[model samples]
Target: MASTSAPARHVPGFSAPAVGFEEPFAMLEACHERVQRTLALLDRLREHVRQQGADESARQAARDVLRYFDVAAPLHHEDEELHVFPLLLAQAAPEMRTLVQRLQQDHVDMVADWAAARVPLQALAQGEIEGFSESAEALFDRFAARYASHIHHEERQAYPAALHLLEPALLGRMGQEMAHRRGAPER
Candidate 1:
């Protein structure tokens, strides 16, 4: 089978930019960029599987997608939930409260979506399946689309509003907590 790995390299934002937790909002934005890259990889993996079957490249792509959505994505969402959303809920207007609530729900929905999406990906990664079923393909599409929309909402609306509300001290605390959770050493 022809290697499909070459295209994976061209997926934008595949290598995340260096953004330390010292700038929490920038870190979160960088996570969004990573999310976009991973989603692109997921789309490409799906296409590759359809055309080329479960080769090593496809297996590696499946593993890559699983690792991101399983580990980093959850941590990123937790950072927003624990640090960003609570602040917005307490201090911002009712509209912001609603927005945070919606975002929180998006996090929940995404977890569920990932649960469903992970099954086929796990199978693909293990080389048990040659390609996604039609239903799995649809699930993948919805998963990627939902993330794209969710990231847009957070970036264009939620992050800016929350950033305006946070003081320097809170930002420092937020950064520290974020780094500590990831087990990074104190700087």
Candidate 2:
């Protein structure tokens, strides 16, 4: 007998349509929006696992979170490292230079934190939420907190500094490189 229950639908945290590649700054902002949504999904997954014990919804959420962080995040970080950070490192004022260095270190810390958080998420994806430990939840909390702070710093300090320093040509080149890195067709 077919189950009468309706198929589960994704509960997205927010809806921010992706912008065009030509608008590189806008694209970065859009990516940040997606990151926020994915992080929220991670938080929801924790609750779902706790309450529902790795049901289909929890499994799906784990997979979604894993896919985003594993795939999209690296590209986004590369976009910042390759396209955004260099300009600030080379040309920004002394105060901004210090900020850029801190931002660069934040990227490294984020990668480590994500590695720690991914273990339980991987288990959750495999319908093994029983294996989720308190340590994993603590790691995830730290990871999410670090990401929030990192995003704030980048949006407030690093991105604006890069925008101010990069002229139209450099910005175009950065966008093109970003698209190429993602295997996306350049517009």
Candidate 3:
């Protein structure tokens, strides 16, 4: 018998993710979309756990959430730290500097919390039913609160600063770099 690799599947009308100097808005939008996706999954996982129906598929879904948390979420945060936040700091007044600094502190705090959070998520993924649901729900609440606050901070503070400080040309460049760094398709 001959073995053959299957052809790649494509969703109809789907293009590669947008990528280029034109994509900062889209890049930010994609991160927010991922946040929404994880939040929905978290809600479903909690529901499954409540009903005591968190079987193998539930466990696998739990694992998928963790994978995105580990990979995409942290990278997004790092991108802000390296690119977005520093640019704000460089141009903000002394009074405004403290808020940017606080945002930076939030990033550190978030990363630390992430390290602790993995324990509960792993427990969920492994189907450790004893306290997994309660622990996970609590962790998820904290994570959600932190994220809600963080994104709000960006919206109210950092994003405004970026828009104010960066020229149209620089913003365009930043957008391009962000899209490429995120591996959204090459354009």
Candidate 4:
């Protein structure tokens, strides 16, 4: 008798729909949603590796996480550094200024953390490893934790404060610059 079980289904990672650059703040917030989803995927990948030992699904998940952090994440940071941070630094109150400085440092730290985390992930994505080392897992944990805190701070405080400070004209200009840098079509 032939088997009747269905083949396994591969569910792709969740990604929020793209928001246009015309709404730059919304675009940034959308990026935050992507960040959270990618991080969740990373967590799932880690667990999958532990149980499944770098199967094709695990490898693909590693690739997805790497691609987002490598490409989209840096651009998101640049969007804030170039457009958002300057406005806050120039006009927001001293407390907000301190928060922005800390956020900037968070960006620096995240870059360093990603550099370390990328190594084992690269090996996994290339089918060179079955699972992460203790140190590598720790690196991943720290990286995710930092991003959680950083995103929370930005969403709760920095974004609202910056949005309040920006006039419509400046916001439009900021959006244009962001779109130009990413080669995104203007709407």
* Candidate 4: segments with Cα more than 4 A from true spot: 1-18
**Higher-TM-score candidate of 3 and 4:** 4
Quote the positional error of residue 73 for candidate 1 in Å.
Answer: 0.3
Best by TM-score: 1
- C-alpha lDDT of all candidate models, in order: 0.84, 0.78, 0.67, 0.84
Candidate 2 residue 81 C-alpha distance from true site, Å: 0.5
Clashing pairs in 1: none
lDDT for 97 in candidate 1 is 93
RMSD of each: 5.9, 6.5, 6.3, 7.8
Q: TM-score for every candidate vs. truth?
A: 0.90, 0.88, 0.78, 0.89
* RMSD in angstroms between candidate 4 and the native structure over all alpha carbons: 7.8
The TM-score ranking, best first, is 1, 4, 2, 3
Candidate 3 Cα lDDT to native: 0.67
The candidate, 1 or 4, that scores higher on TM-score is: 1
Candidate 2 lDDT by residue in tens digits, 1-187: 0011113322222234447567788888878888888889888878877776888878878888887788678778888988888888899899988988888898899899998889888987886656468899889889888888989999998898889888899888888886676655446
Per-residue alpha-carbon lDDT of candidate 4 for residues 1-187, written as tens digits (9 for 90 to 100): 0111213322122133456677889988888887888899899999999987999999988988887888778878999999889999999999999999999999999999999999999999999988999999999999999999999999999999999989999899998987666655455
In candidate 2, which residue ranges exceed 4 Å CA deviation? Answer: 1-18
Q: The CA-based lDDT of model 4 is what?
A: 0.84
How are the candidates ranked when ordered by lDDT, highest leading?
4, 1, 2, 3
TM-score, predicted candidate 3 vs. hidden true structure: 0.78
lDDT-best of 1 and 2: 1
